[model samples]
Target chain A: MGRWEPNATDRLVVAALELFETNGYENTTVIGIAERAGLTKSTFFRHFQDKREVLFGRSSLADVLAEGIAKAPADAEPLEAVACALELLAQDVFTPERRDFIARRQAVVATHPELREREALKGLGLIAAMTGALERRGLPALTARVTAELGALALELAYTRWGSASRDFTEVAREALDEVRSAAPAR
Target chain B: MGRWEPNATDRLVVAALELFETNGYENTTVIGIAERAGLTKSTFFRHFQDKREVLFGRSSLADVLAEGIAKAPADAEPLEAVACALELLAQDVFTPERRDFIARRQAVVATHPELREREALKGLGLIAAMTGALERRGLPALTARVTAELGALALELAYTRWGSASRDFTEVAREALDEVRSAAPAR
Candidate 1:
């Protein structure tokens, strides 16, 4: 039977988060992070290009969301397709156990302008991923783009609240999406 | 009678765009940009925080857009307030005479990942500006946020199309807004 094994990347993320919080993000170094994670600097570079990327964790979220959007029911509306993907993210990406890490990551990014800029750019990429995924489902390009924009806003709100909301991330995301859809006027 | 005088900031932008395009972004430097513009390196730093900031200009766009949104008719809808601001931008910020510089800046940014990241984050700021302005007009927070997202998309599309569209930027922006509105569903 397969047993749990240590992941160098996860170890690096945990170490980086702690160091970034305690020593301040600007004061933290890649070598320091690697040492804290019980690995070498080269091992750290192998996992992440830089310290800033440790919190982003590559492009897995986009892949997960795209796969979920593609798997949505055929009769689903444009936003519904996005909703399906968000639910997947809540259940898988934003699991209860990872809430603390995600919250800590948000806090670190919030205080650092450089991290905030990177996070904002990362958000644009997620929107692009969602838009492209929806287009592959045969939705009109504008419809897909618009839905993705709204979905990104909802996703952003959910991420901000996931750290402290009383309800689960799933419920928060659903409410966020509803709030977005309510404000969006019908054609 | 007043005579036209050179603006150091404008000269720097022109020089930066040319250098970024010809010498490549990475190879270009503040000294080179200043020399190309016939200004001192100190002058360049005085005008911009860095080379990337030169391409983005100051926070004038946000201020202009916010002011425009505030000046919209009292009865204007949330998106209409955004539209009014866009029209003002087209007339003032994205005027025909500045189209070439703006287009070149866009091309230069498209070629550089660093510049694109800066541009993306700047976009978030614009969305924030629009949202706050809409809220000031008495729109609900969610309504303002959602409209700003849609409006930001339209503004992005308009900016991309501004250089070569047969119509003017103002018309382009208006049409872009209409396209966004059409795709958005009525409440």
Candidate 2:
């Protein structure tokens, strides 16, 4: 069995974010990040392919969201399923400490156009995952796709709001989900 | 006034798409596109700053939609204003021939990750414009942002449906708008 390296990936992420904020993303190298984290470069590579991956890569994020959607009640509507999924993600994946890191990372991403694009792609991937889950639940293709996109948008809004204060992520997320649902025109 | 060069830009776009499809985006060059279009390289530079711009740049599209939104009736809701703006874009910007080229360009973008990122940025730009227009219409900040995102998502859904057959872009766009609005969970 491998030795326990508890929070190894999280340590690398925090180290990378600190270096990125102090030295800028372009100037911060993987070796520097690993050293700052008191970890080896090989360990860094094991957790992330490169420095940018340290900022953007979170494969488990999609898995958490998709699993949440899959575990929603069988009779839930497509939008409700998405809402449940995001709420679960807010509760399970994004703890108070991770929220702080995410806010800092957002600030860094805003400064660089390439990072912004990568962040946008990550958002799209989340939406795609949610869409796939909804499709498996037998919603029509277009409905599933639109609900997933709305869910992503709500998450973004909630995260932005949550970053500015000490509000609960779940409360902020529910408010965002409510905002989109209320804005819909009468059928 | 300078001498007329009617359809100069259109010709370049067609040539670029054809060459991108035939030679691949990486292999295609500005010189090859100009030659294929029976135009000078100087003329190519006049319309597009570079080869990739031919596939991605269209500044006037956002202008058309924003203008349409601004001209909507004063009493129109934020989402209604967005729908009006998108209808104008579908009618004024996306003619049948343009749709054909757009489809080809979308296919090319699908083949390249870099192009896909550029495409996503362009989509973000459109949403930003719509959001700004909605804000001007007196909607709250978050409402404007979310509605604008939904507008962009609707346009994307409509365009995808339109590409598979000969359909009215306005009708498809409206249907997408309707679908999302109807799918909203009850308050």
To one decimal place, how large is model 2's interface RMSD in Å?
2.5
lDDT of 1 by residue, A60-115 (tens): 88888898899999999888888899889887888888888788888999989878
> What are the TM values for chain B, all candidates?
0.93, 0.90
DockQ of each: 0.63, 0.38
| Minimal lDDT window, size 10, model 2 chain B | B178-187
Candidate number achieving the greatest lDDT relative to the actual structure:
1
Off by over 4 Å in 1: A1-5, B1-5
* The 10-residue segment with the lowest total lDDT in model 1 chain A: A1-10
- Clash number for each model: 7, 0
RMSD per prediction, one decimal?
3.6, 3.5
**Model 1 reaches what TM-score against the true structure?**
0.93
The CAPRI-style docking tier of model 1 reads: medium
List, residue by residue over B1-187, the lDDT tens digit for candidate 2: 3345778888888888898899899999899998988888888888888888887775476788788889999999776887888789877877776777677777998988778777887888888888898888888877787678778888888878887669778888889888766664554
